[model samples]
Target: MMDQLLLALQGLRRSRVWLSIFRREQLPQTEADWLAMNRRNFFVHILPAKIHKGSTRLSYNWIWMGVISTWLFVILTITGLFLMFYFVPSVERAYDSIKEIMNSVTLGRFMRNMHRWAANLMVFAVFLHMMRVFWTGSYQKPREFNWVIGVLLFVVTVLFAFSGYIVPWDQLGYYAAKIASNIADGVPYIGPQVKQILLGGTDLQQPSLLRWYVIHVFFLPLVIVLLIGIHFWRIRKDDYSKPVEYERGRRD
Candidate 1:
C-alpha cells in the first residue's frame, strides 16, 4: 500500500496540469540552477537553499529564539484577528466588549488569553533573539546592517505591544496609556507635540482610544510586516546567518 501510494504521488507531482496550476514553475534541479532561479522568485528567495550543517546544531546556535519569535507572531496574529470580531474600540464600549467576549462568546476568553500571552511571549522572544545574536557575535561584519534592522524591529515590537495594551480601555489599560503618553511628553524638543499627537488632545479620551486602535490594528502591523520581509531577505543574503566561526576555522 505504501509503495502504491508513493507511485501515485510521484505521478501526481509530474502531472502537467498540476504542475502548471499548483507548482506554477519547476524548482531548479541543481544548486547553481536554484541560485539563479532564486533571484526572481520572491517566496523562494526569502530563505537560502542551504545552510551550513553547523548552523543547525543547538550547541552552535543555542536556542532558536528567532524561530520562536516568528511562531509567537503567527499565534498572536491569529488570536488577534479572532478577537477583533468581538472588540469595540470606543472608550465607552471597549471594556464592555471585552467583558461580553469573556462571559458570552464561546472560547472567547481562551482566545483572548492566548492573544495576550502570545503577544507578551513575542516581546520576550525578540529580546532573547537579540541577546543570542549579540552573544554569538552575529552582529559584526556583513550583518551590521541586519543588526540595526533587528534593533528597529525590537522597538516596533515594543510599540506594538504598548499600543495594543489600551484596546480594552479598562482601568489598567487606561492608566498604562496615560503613563506612556506622559513619557512621550518628556521628549526633548517635540515633547508636548508628541504627546498631543499620540493622545489626539490634551488628555486620553475617545480620540485617544480611537487613535490607539488604529495604530495597533492597522499602522503598526503593516509596518512590522514590511520590516519582517526585509529581515528575512537580509537573512537569506547573509547566507542563512551561519555563525561567523563557521567560515573561519571551525569546520570539522
Candidate 2:
C-alpha cells in the first residue's frame, strides 16, 4: 500500500495535468532555457529577465526600501488574515475578541503583534522608498507617472493602516479615528460629506466599524494590489532608473 501511494504521488508530480496548473508548460533544461522560460511564463514574465548590476547595487538602493516595503506588506497580509480568525468587527464584541485572542488563542498574540508592527513598518518603508526614488532622480521624465502612482500607493497604505486601527475597538483607536474623521471634515468642498460618509453619521460607532473593516480588508487591498501590479509592470517596461555612473557612461 505504501509503495503504491508513493508511486502515485511521484506519477502525479511528473504528470502534465499537475505541471499545467502549478508551472509553465515549458520545462527549462539549461541555464539559457531557464532565462527564456521566465519571459514566456505568465507569472515570471512580468519580472525582468536581466537587471543592470549598477541598478541593483546596495550603495545605490540602500537596503532596497521598495522591496522591504513589499515584504512588509506580505507580512501584514498574512498576520492580518490570521488575526481575522479571532477578530469580530463589531463595536461591542471587538475589544473582547481581541482580549480573547491574546489570552486564549494559541499564537494569536504573536500574530497580532506581527500585524501591528508590519503595518507600522510598511508606512515608514514606503516613505523611505519614495525618498530613495526621489534622491536617485528615478522620477524623471518617463518615470513621472510611476512616481504619481507610488504616491497614491503610499496614501492607500496609510488609509489601510488607519482603517484597521479601529478594529480592536479600543479607546486609543476610537478617539484617534474620531480625530481623523473630524480632520477630514475640515477639508474643502466635500469635507463634511466625506466625513459623513466615512463615519456613516455624526460619530464613530457600529457603522464606522463596519465601513472601516470593509475598507481595511477588501477595498483597499484590491486597490493596492492593482496599483502594485501596475507599478511593477511599468518597471518591467521602463526598467528602473540606473545609477549615475551608468547614465554618464551611456551619455559619453
Candidate 3:
C-alpha cells in the first residue's frame, strides 16, 4: 500500500497541471538543481537555499521571535482589514462605530481583539528579536546595513501601533494623540511644523483622526512591507548569523 501511494504521488507530481503550477517535476537533489530551483521559484528565491544549523536552534534564537513578529503582523493586517469594513474614521462616529462593531457585527469583537492584541504582541516580539540579534552579535560586519534596516522597521512598527491606537477616537485614544502631538511639538527646531503635519492642526480633531487613519491603514503598511522585503533580501544575501559558542577555558 505504501509503495503504491509513493508511486501515485510521484506520478501526480509529474503531471502537467502540477508542473504548470510548481514549474518543476521533482524536488532538487543536487547543489546545481537547488540553485536552479531557487532561481526559478519566486517564493523560494527569497529564502536561503541552505541555513546554518545554529540558526535553527531554539536556545540560540529564543523562540524564533522574528518569525513570530512577522506572523503577528500578518494577523494584524487581516484582522485590521476586517475591522476597517465596520470602522468609521470620522471623529464624531469613530467611537460609536467601534461600539457598533462590538455589538452588532458578526465576529467583529473577536477580530478587533485579535488585531489589538496582535499589534501589542508584534511590538513586543520585534523588540525581543532585535535584542536577540544584538546579543548574538548578528549585527556585525556584512549585516550592519541590515541592522540599520531592522532599526527602521522597529521604528515604523512603533509608529504603526501608535497611529492605530488613535483611530477609535475614544477618550483614551484622544488623550493619547494629544500627548503624542505635544511631544512632536517639542522637537528641537521643527517642533511646531512636525506637530502640524501630524495633527493637521494645533489640536486633535477630525483631521487628526483622518490623517492617522490613512497613516495606520495605508502609509505605514506600505512602508513596513517595503522594509520587510529589503530586510529579507539582505538576510538571504548575507546569510544567517550563526550563534557564538564559548569553550570553558578558551575563546575562539
Candidate 4:
C-alpha cells in the first residue's frame, strides 16, 4: 500500500502538481531529485546529522494509532455480524432483537456494550490524535496530501457513527433516523430527492430500514476499508511524522 502511495505521489511530484501554488524553489529539496524522487531526499534535508540512523526508523505511536483503529473496526465487524444473527430490519423486530441480545444470547450483552464503548472511544482517540498531528505541523509541505487523507479518515469515523445509530430501533433510534432523513432532505435542490432515496418515500418505513442496513452492513464499510488503505499508505510514503519540538524525544 505504501509503495503504491509513493508511486502515485512520485508521479504527481515529478509532474510538479503543485507548481503554481507551492513553486519550485519554495520547497526545501532540489527540483531534480523531486522530478521523480528517483533521487531520494537525504536525511540532511530534514534532520540534523548528529541523530542516530535508527532514530528515523518508524513511529510506533502512529502505527499504534492505526492498529487500535483497525482493531476497533474488526471488533465492530464481528459484533455487528453476531448481532445480525438476531436482528431484523422491520421496525417491529428491531427493538425486540436488541432485547433478545441483551437477555438471551450468551454474553451478547457484554459484547454489545464493549462494541459500543470501543466505537465511541475510537472516535475520540482519532480526533485527539488528529489534533495532535495538526498542532505539531505533521501536515506540512510534502505531507499536505496525507493531511487531506487524515481529513477523509475523520469523515469515515462520522460515517460509522451515522450508520451505527439506527441499529437499536428504540424510540430514540427511530427519531434519530427521522431527524437524519430530514437533514438528508435539506440538501438544497436535491434535498427531497435524497430523502426519497434514503427513506424510500416521504416517511420512514421498511424501505428506510433496508437502505440504512445496506449502507451499514456493506457499502460504508467497504469505503472505510479503502480510505484506511490510503491513510496507512500516506504515512509510509511521507515517512514517519516528526513530533512537536517541545515533545521531541519525550517518548510519545
- How far off is residue 98 in model 3, in Å? 0.5
lDDT of each: 0.85, 0.86, 0.89, 0.73
Question: Which pairs of residues clash in candidate 4, taking residues 3 or more apart in a chain or in different chains?
Answer: none
66-146 in candidate 3: lDDT tens per residue? 889999999998999899899999988999999999999999989999999999999999999999999988887678999
The TM-score of predicted model 1 comes to 0.86
Compute the lDDT of residue 48 as modeled in candidate 2.
76
Model 1 over residues 167-220: C-alpha lDDT tens digits?
899888899889989999999999999999989999889999998998898999
lDDT against true structure, model 4: 0.73
TM-score of each: 0.86, 0.86, 0.87, 0.71
* CA displacement after TM-score superposition, residue 12 of candidate 4 (Å): 45
Number of colliding residue pairs in model 1: 0
| TM-score for candidate 3 | 0.87
Per-model C-alpha RMSD? 3.7, 3.2, 3.8, 12.4
Model 1: how far residue 158 lies from native, Å: 1.2
Candidate 4, RMSD to the unseen true structure:
12.4
Highest-scoring model, lDDT: 3
Which segments of candidate 1 are over 4 A away from where they belong?
1-40, 249-252
> What ranges in model 4 sit over 4 Å off?
1-63, 244-252
Query: RMSD in Å for candidate 3, one decimal?
Result: 3.8
Tens digits of per-residue lDDT for model 2, 1-252:
999998898788789998877664446788798887777777888777788888888878978898899999899889888988888999899999999998999998899889989999999999999998989888876788899999999999998888777767799879877988899999999999999988989888899888878888999999999999989888877786788767765445
